[model samples]
Structures are given as structure tokens and as C-alpha cells.
Target: MDSRSLPNSSKSSKSSRAEVSVKRSPVEPRVSTLLDVISISMGETG
Candidate 1:
């Protein structure tokens, strides 16, 4: 979300993309677990 606030100066475009990816790495495991849990919940609901 904050990424939208990034300067459109052009110079930051490449570097900001890399920063976003790096920031997402730590949440990968948690996101995976959440997806698995959601799948199981959907199966039960259906």
C-alpha cells in the first residue's frame, strides 16, 4: 500500500520492486500456512 506513495521519479521504480520482494520473504511461511488452513475450512463448509 505504501508503495503507491513512492516517488514517480523513475529512479526508484527498480529499487522499490526489489525492496517489496525482500519485505515479503519473511511472510511466505505464514501465508502458506494460512492458505492451507483456508482450504481445509472451505472443504468443511462445503
Candidate 2:
């Protein structure tokens, strides 16, 4: 059960990251960097 759930969680995280990348593409570089940091922190905690 743990092995199965690990891949599923990673998959969902990838999808969410992709969506965020697309939405932030046109935004400022500084904002994008900030978002990247936030996402990384969230990933580590979660």
C-alpha cells in the first residue's frame, strides 16, 4: 500500500507543478522564482 500510494502522490504533484508553470509563464521572473521556492517548500513538507 505504501509503495502504490507514493507514485500516485508524485504523479499528482507533477500535474500540479505543470499547471502552475503554465499559469506563471507570462508573469515576472521574480514572482516565478518566489513561486518555485514556495512549491519546493510545500513539496518538502508534504
Residue range 1-46, candidate 2, lDDT tens digits: 6899999999999999999999887787878889999999999999
Give a tens-digit lDDT track for model 1, residues 1-46: 4665665545578888889999999999999999999999999999
> Candidate 2, which ten residues in sequence have the lowest lDDT sum?
23-32
Separate clash counts for every candidate: 0, 0
Candidate number with greatest TM-score: 2
Error of 1 at 37 (Å): 1.5
Can you give the TM-score per candidate against the true fold?
A: 0.53, 0.55
Any residue pairs clashing in model 1, and if so which?
none
TM value for model 2: 0.55
lDDT of each: 0.86, 0.93
